[model samples]
Every structure is written in structure tokens, then in C-alpha cells.
Target: MKNWKRRESFLPVAVLLLLVSLIASACGSGANTNTAGGAEAANGSPSAAAGSSTSGADGKKEEKTEKTKVIWWHSMGGELGKAADQLVADFNASQDGIEVEAVYQGTYDESLNKMKASMDSKSGPSLIQVYEIGSRFMIDSGAITPVQDFIDQEGYDVSQLEENIASYYTFDGKQYSMPFNTSNPILYYNKDLFKAAGLDPDKAPATYGEVKQAAQTLAAKGTPASFAIYGWFMEQFFANQGAEYVNNGNGRSAPADASLVNGDAGIQTLEWWKEMVDSKAAINLGRKTDDTKKAFLAGQISMTLDSTASLRGIVDGAAGKFEVGTAFLPKPDGAEGGVVVGGASLWILNNKPEAEQKAAWEFIKFLAQPETQAKWHISTGYFPITKQAYDEQIVKENLDKYPQFQTAIDQLHASKPSQATQGAVMGVFPEARQIVEGAIEEVLGGSKPVKQALDAAAEAITGKISNYNKTVNVK
Candidate 1:
């Protein structure tokens, strides 16, 4: 196991604790007065209220017709988004006192940025979809409410939800968000290319060594073996092979005190990547490709590792022109270890009125229902977060019709959560990933050795962590 250290300069955690303590103290009496500029009320628009109206038995107005509104910002689009929209609609219709409004907020990063800016300005949607990478930032911001507390306050059954998904959003003993669209990377291959390379299309490579051999064979046959050099993908490869990236997977308080990207496992992983690059079997698609997906769909590359979320787009874009097969990411020498979870979760903002908070919780609960989760998973290629959904007869039946939907679920089942593989919660991780990606590019471009590139990248990340820590107390 990698050494774990809480990031120094505990201001971020301190501030969070202080704010939470203050909120608890101020609201200790359980008073539900509206404060913080009535942002909650502003978000709970009149339309939401109107949409909640219902008729009495005698066709007269119901005596008690109060309704609460929940504004949600999400990045899911297309079929998956529509499925989510329908879930919200159904939830709203099922209850007369809560109306949940779902809005598309562009990509994951865009949604997170919007939420951050809104938090500083003291106004934003009551609920927003945050990628798992944004967990640390959300926790440090003190702008979001912990879902566990909310669940307790509302008397909801936390046990009803899948524990694994719940654990992903938990810090210490409390959960901050509810897992929504969870997924992991899988090996997507072009079957036609496999046949051309004389490999069994049905039998994808089961181990790292086999993958390399296949790549070599494909290259000898004049076909590009693989596409793109994704740092995160490589990180998962190392993790699945029982290697650590940062100490304790960047889960602790301070990252600088626990840097391990230059450790033995890290060095070995980088060397393996270098060997692949040197073999000329894999092509280094520039980070800013006009469209990497386009290249894959067009048969420019035979195999690639990416999020299962890309399934629908690739299948739709290909339009039944090519046979697509999905498999788990291969491990080195048939090594056994679980893959890490990717994708995002939905977080509820703090400072909302009691009524609105209740409504938000209601909507979140609805989203966690097995039917909704299964529908979302089937439509989006993201694994259903709840175990019931995964085992649902409906989902099982649909697997025959849409085989791609099962790949992500299989990968998730094969995954075991670890401090290293569960994922990194460090601040500025998106920026750090870009820096690491750039370093990977340099190594692939023959400008530097893998060890040197990684060392420089680690230094840069450590500097960023130090600078960020200075600005925000982490304790």
C-alpha cells in the first residue's frame, strides 16, 4: 500500500469544519427561517409550485397545497438525459408537494465551474451533478450539504441504497453526495480489425502481455494497434495491476506530503508505457485531437480504452457499419485487482430552505430507485449504481437486446474499491491530470525519458498542491 498523508495546511478542512459547526450552532434550535439571500426560494420558481397543484375529491381546490421546488443542473444529454428528465417528471407527478426541475449544464467541468462560481456569488441550482474528481473541492468549499445528515433528518432509509455506491461519496463516516452515473473504463475493440489482424474477434486480450502481443501482431500486419495515450487510462492500468499513482490515491488531506508518482510501482508502469510507445505498435493521438472518437469510429484505430459513457456516441456514429465488442481492461500477467470508479455524482447545495432541501432529497431518492437507475444505465452505458438495478429482471432481459450495456456493469463488478483505485480526491486534480497528460505527451514524443518526465510532472503537481494549500487551510 502507498503511504498516505493528509495534505498540510489544513485550512480547507478547518474552514469546512468551522462552517459546518457554525451552521449547526445557528440552526441548533431547528428553526427553518430563510437566510442567505433566499437563493433557495429564487430557485424554487412559481412554475414548480404551479406544477404541483392537484384537485380535491369534489373538484375543489385542496386545502393544503404547498409545494417545494428543486433545481438540478446535470451534464447528461441525448438519450440518457431524456431518461433522467423522464425520471424527474415521474417523480414530480408521483408527489404533489415536490417539483424537480432538471437542466442541462454542459460537460462535467462546466457544471462544476458553474456551481463553484454560483457558490461564491451565493446563488445557484439547489442540486448539481459533480464528477467524482470534484469531491475534494466540493468538500472544501463548504457550499454543499452532506447527504447522510439530510437522510437522517428526513428519516430516509440509507440501507435501501447500494452500499458500494454510497461509499464512493463518503468521507470519514458521512456521505456528501448520492452516486448517480457511475462507470469504469473498458476495452472497446473493432471486431473487423480483429479479424483482419487474425485475432479471434470474440476473444479479446485477457491480460496485459496478451494485449502487447496482439498489438505487436497487428502492427506487423500494418494496422494501428491502439489509439490515444490517456494518462488517466494508464493510471487505471497501473492501479489494476496493483500499482499506486499518488500515495493513498490522493484521498488524504495533504498531497504534497504523500507524493508517490515516482515510487517503484509508478516507475514500472511508466516503463511499461514507454515500452509500448517504443514498440511503434500504438499511435500517440495528440491530446487536442480534432476528434479521437471520430478516428476510432472511422476504423483508424482497432482498440481503445475509454469511459463506457462513450458507447452510445460510438454506436450511434458508427450506425451499424462496424461490429463493436466490449471487454474489460487487461491486467498485466493476468494480475487480479479491481478497476476504479469513474463518472459523476449529484450533490445538493447547502443554504437551501428546509422545504427545498426536503424536496431535493426527495428527488434524489427517486433517482436512486432501482427502475430509474436501471433505465439510466441501459440508456447511457453508465453502470447502475444500485445492486437491485443491476440484478433487475428488466435489465437482465434487455442485456440480450443491447449487449454494450453489460460491459460497464461487468467491469464494475470486477472492480474493488481501494484508497488508490477508489479515486483521487485532491484539489486541482483536473489541472494535475492535464499536466500529467502533457508529460506523457513529451515522453511519447521522444523529448524525455519516462522517469524524467514523470519526475518533472510530480514536482509540478507538488508545487501546485503547496500553492493551493497556502491559499486554503486544509485541516
Candidate 2:
């Protein structure tokens, strides 16, 4: 009985250790990934030897290697997923050395959560797509080999990658992930509503104040409420106002100590927004972006703010309803800060074999190539992350057919980058955004004053930051 009891108690502890070991083996370093399979993956960069081993040591032509199957977990669905599937097929056909299989994970947040379990089992995919908001979490998890690591090892020149997109994904002066399917927030207005409201259809609102005026005019014209009450919009407004999202230079330098969001920028934006709702100039559409978008597509709303990636859907939805015009997101006080990149990126997982890593990197590079990006942008309406993609014939034809498409690209190029625009980097950002949205709801519902609601949210977020920092041991 004593021996049995001891074994039972020790079982859980042993299992926990095994799990930890598996996770560490999977993530700690891909530098040493050849303990099994009898085949040595390369040395140093793991894939280094395999990469250059197209020939043997005798200077004789080497035979073809076995196909390395690379698993790619992504959150894309619908049309985007179809495009991804086509690309994967194209990539597989292009090379006999690698076979990439694209698997659809849930949403971005769900992918992150599910990835943790797979990492613990040392069965994580070779590549995972992570959203921009998950940047800090992915870094702190240490489950990734930074893109710069592969770049330096392979001497890859990333000069073709757009700087505006790179400015967001880079951490500590090094690129962390390869930017993919990038987008920026822009204003989409109905020209028919504008004409009915006696406003110029050719010009767009350039500031928050103008948006309100346009909303008031549209509201008077029996147009649906203008704009969404989404948390992402709040973040954009703060950045455009040149307000710091958090301390420590929005966590670009060091971990953020506290949130600076409840100050002037937050108060002014939220207060005016509440006034808009109360005056019926705008309606509080709540948290879901799709609801706001649906209202606009149904012609219930005149104008809205959404990611440029949504342009294709909106265009399709408005086929015969009304003309859709897009412009840069209206700035608060017309400040100088630029906007951050939205959308996800390709992160190469560590603890994978060198051959697999090299294979995954090949696919990532192919995805970023100008021709591929041009095709992607034309199909999905997502801004091509590469500058050269804009020069492609397909992209140029798309731009000519839809002039509003160029608005987002021009806006990205014209604005100057700053700490505010680069966006806040925090492991707790997803939670913080939830809290902020809740606060906005309370203020709009008249349960709290704008400043008071924002202050309370900020204080709560500071506690979350401390806890998250503790969990990640980031100090």
C-alpha cells in the first residue's frame, strides 16, 4: 500500500516534468534538432548544411532529398483560406524538396491558445500565423526563431519588404516575423448618402471633428449611424492623436510600466464619441466589427471605419446598393502620428528539424515575393506588404478599377512613424483592449463619466500588466 501510494503521488509530478521537457525541447532552440530520425539536420543554423548540401563533399551532384513535410497552422477562413490553399499548392509544385500543408486553426487568439498545447507535446507546426496583437505574447513565449535569425544565417536581404509594414513587426531593431496579409484602418463612406446630405462626394472628412459634422449631416438625412465603436478604432484614434498607449515608449524600448491611455486623448475621444451617440449622430454598435459592417452594407449606415482588408467584401456587398469610397482614417486634431499595421505574419517555430525550418523559410519567402503578394492583394483586397507588388500589372489594373484602393497605400506612405503609431507592445494587450471596450460601453451608456471610466479601465489594465509581466517573468 505504501509503495502504491508513493507511485500515485509521483505520477502527476512526473507527468508535469515530462510536459515541460517536451515544451522546452520544442522551443528552446532549433539549433539542436537532430537527436532523432538518424539524419543530421544541418549544423549551426540547423538547415545550413542541408541548405548548402545540394551537392555532396566530393563535389559530385547530389541526388534529390526526401520531401520535408512542413505543417502551417493559420487562422484564415473563407476566401482568404481558398487563396492560401491555392498558394500552398503552387509552392508544393514549385519544389520537390518540401511539402507544405496548410491547416486552418480557429481565430488568431484561438491559434495562440491551441499552439501552447502543441508546443508542450513537441508537435507544434513548423510555421504558425500570428496576428499583430500577439506579437509580445509570441516573443515572450520564446516559441519562435526570429526572422532576423534566419535572415542573418541565410544572408537574406529583406530590402524589398515595405518599411511601413516592417516598422510594426520589428522588435528591438530586429524583424520578429515576416509580414503577411497586412492592412491599415481607413474610412469607407457612401457617396450616395453624401450627395443626399448636400456634401461633396469627392472629398472625405480629414479630422475627427469633420467626421462628426458629416455624421450629423448624414443622420439628419435619415442615414444610419456613422462609424463603429470598436476597440481597434479607439486604439487608432489614440495613435492618430499622438497619445502614448502605454509608458516606456509604448513598450518599444522596455516593458511598459503603466498605461497613458486615460489622459487627454482618451477623455476627448470618448467624450465626443458619447456625445455623438447621445445626439444620434452615431450609434454605439458595440464590440463586434461585423455588426457594424453589416449595418453599412445594408445601407443602414452611411460611412464606417474598418480595415482595408474589408474592401473586397464591402465592394461585393454593395454591388448595386451605393458607391463605396475609402480614405485615410480621420485623425484626432489632425496630428502627425502614423498608423500601425494590422493583420498577421508568418512565424517560424523553433525546435523543428533544420530541413523543415529551411523548407518553412522557403515558403515564407515565396509568400512575400512581389508577384505572389500582387496576386494576393488583387484577390483579397489586402494591401500588398511589399512595395514592389504595387508595380505589378495585376495590382495596377486593380488600382485603376478601384481608385479607393490606393488611398490606404498612399496614407501609409504619407504619414510619419512615431512611438504612438508603431503601436503598443504588451503581452496583456488583448485583455487590455477588452477592458477598454467595456469602459467605452459604460461611458456611452451613461453609467460613468468618460474620464472616470477611462481612468478605472487604465488602473485595471495596469494590474493586468503587472500580472502578465509576472507570468512571463519579464520584470
* 109-176 per-residue lDDT for model 2 (tens digits): 55666777677567778999887777876776666778888899989878888887887888668898
TM-score of 2: 0.86
Error in Å for residue 256 of model 2: 1.0
TM-scores vs. true structure, each candidate: 0.83, 0.86
The segments of candidate 2 whose C-alpha lies over 4 angstroms from its true place after superposition are 1-64
Best model per TM-score: 2
Clashes of 1: 15
lDDT: worst 10-residue window of model 1: 29-38
Candidate 1 per-residue lDDT, tens place, 1-475, comes to 1233333222343454433332222221111010011111112223444534568788986655656768898876655567667777778778787778777766666566566556545578888888776677676666677788887876877776655556668776678899888766788778888898889999998776777777777777665555455555656776686666665445543343344566665666666666776997777666532245667788777777767767766766766778888888877675656676777788877767767876788888888888888887766667777777867876887677668757767676667766656555666566566667777778878898888988888887676665555444543
lDDT of 1: 0.66
